[model samples]
Target: MVGERSKQAFERAKRVLVGGVNSPVRAFRAVGGTPYFADRGEGPYLYDIDGHRYIDYLMSWGPLIWGHAHPDIVRAIAETAARGTSFGVPTELETEMAEEIVELVPSVEKVRMVSSGTEATMSAIRLARAATGRTAIVKCIGCYHGHADSFLVKAGSGVAALGLPDSPGVPQSVAERTLTVPYNDADAMEKLFADRGDEIAAVILEPVAGNMGCVLPLPGYLEAVREITRRYGSLLIFDEVITGFRVGLGGAQARFGVLPDLTTFGKVIGAGLPVGAYGGRKDLMALVAPEGPVYQAGTLSGNPLAMAAGLTSLRMLKRAATEGAYDRLESYGRRLVEAFCQTASHCGLPATGHAIGGMFGLFFHSGPIVDFETAKACDQALYADFFHEMLAEGVAFAPAQLESGFMSMVHGEAEIEKTIEAMERAIPRIAARRR
Candidate 1:
């Protein structure tokens, strides 16, 4: 529990790095504490610079599905790196990765890699605009599609954690083009299309929203979106950055049986490396440069290291799929959710928990959370208390209530049991703070 080294490191970091962190969420601003500096991760555990270890539920914000530095991924990266880091030229690994992605994901026909999720989404939006010859894009209020100017309005994750309605630097003109709607509300979406169907280029969203604390799509909502978008001549974009391989071999689209026109992906695809991709119908993806008019390019788009790591991860996932990896994830996820509910009830605190596959959320509220408003209504102060208490008990969770906690294949029964025990012990202490 001693974070002396981390505290000292933070003091040094703030003198150089912005907010003493590369990412805003790592600042621990919402959780009211200094961030712990992780030294390394092995299996499901993270060891910090202060010589303290915790059972990690963050999983690098949902990318390390196979757990930290899986030998195969490590070896792949190492071997690829030994050849050359960046060629800025074509490589067979890129083709191999593209083939693997197309084979695994039901919706993707052709994919182009990018360095980050932000780039993938930004490019996808551009493609949508070009293909439909329209400008405005519809985004769910709490769904985050990265930091692109058009997507900053009412975005979730770090923005929600900081309680910012919209980022400051985005121009009014850019924000105006993006329409925001509530998650899981079919009528509102229908009305949006009816009102501006002609001008709307695409409707983009997280098919299974993870940014606003792992909210799942309501029954029939995704289907409604698919049908509505198709009817309106607008493309549907699934920002599967979190859910792609984490949900299943085919992702949320396959899990829910709704195929989107375009899908933006990152996270699990990279196996903890920096990579992102967007792909869909062959005709639509063929529009990207060198093939057609729409333009998108990256210097490190398909870097050998990233491709090797991604390929290794995807291959492992494909193999695991046959052996019921998702089934085990569902079983473990349900156990964790149920455990949280039991612990919350015992502590006399109302709680709502939900999970799909390896992604889950623990809402500090009494009832189901369906949209941004209700999701926000969950007590942040209480969550902060729970987060710190759980951290103290050697369990690491996302520091913000709006971020979902991830479980990995490495989080076995022993780890799950330990996590639940930690939650049970931490809940009383967190509850005591409220009184």
Candidate 2:
């Protein structure tokens, strides 16, 4: 149950903030209950305003790869802030951040910094259109690139959670220019390309489909998309906002060995700061800004604080990668998946899950969830019960069933055990509800 303080805060927030939350999913609309207001976070734990402590797996929706309020990141932000926060002019830190991204990501030869994932993706689309001299962009049905007009056609996350068809504000002209295809269906993608290949400037998608619950690319699926895009003279854009550094140091393109023409990144890149980036082949990226006609600019595109914090985090991640930190995250995620599945079995409830790097997803449905169609078939009502139950037991997952869960480096065996124990209780309660 929500504490009185949180309830009062929410009521107060409703008077000022739209929907009583900045983000739609944070409103707890999908799961029936008052949203718990966060007071602070440390390592793997988040303290709600009501004074409840939770072993947090939300990880601020995948930005906190090192967990919340990491000392190093905090120190970096402090030091950078002491110097200055934002300058409309270029900074050395921005160049350093760009160099780091160029070195780590295989597809990004020249990168442009942005304020959020939406900005990164929207700019990438614009660059693709300019580079290819085409008008249409293809996106997977449930793979959310962002809230950009070109991306909201069949987006997931909050859009799916709210059961909205497509955002109303998006013009019909723009929506039509954005093609839609089912994720993990190579045949559908191939067919779509065959019919309208000439009109497409790019095909953008989440290489791992985190928005629709961490759906993995079907074997050879990414390779096929790459081949098709290359043959059709259309750019392939990988929306790695959620998967970038979270999956591996080099991101999904490196992990899958399938390079995209352009890649958009956020979350882990900023190390929990407000930042995003899009980069690609030098020639393609050269078309943006002063060098070319395709114009995109932001006053705080490479803000000092964001760059400093992200640079520190990336350096730490690079060092940890040398010692197999990503492997440990994967191991932790796998353990959670096992526990979730086993507990569901014990409770006599159908369930399915997948663990990839530090990201995972749980579905209140049977196995073989591949795309939006299958992901939507999950028992959301049952998941709500499980969500509330887990919250009561001091564990936190994403509030919506459609959202993916995250694991942070700070989470150890003890945290994992506590989460599993919470699941142990939560699953049985869900089963009881079903009975």
- Candidate 1's residue-wise lDDT over 188-282, tens digit each? 99998999999999999899999999899999999999999999999999999999989888999999999999999998889899999999999
For each of the candidates, give the backbone clash count.
0, 0
Model 2 segments beyond 4 Å from truth? none
Candidate 2 lDDT at 41 equals: 99
- Which 10 successive residues of model 1 have the least lDDT summed? 426-435
**Model 2 quality (TM-score):** 0.99
TM-score of candidate 1 to 2 decimals: 0.99
Q: Residue pairs in steric clash, candidate 2?
A: none
RMSD of each: 0.9, 0.8
Q: Residues 293-361, candidate 2: write the lDDT tens digits.
A: 999999889988989989998999999999999999999999898899899988888889998999999
Overall local distance difference test of candidate 2: 0.92
CA lDDT of each prediction against the hidden true structure: 0.91, 0.92
TM-score of each predicted structure versus truth: 0.99, 0.99
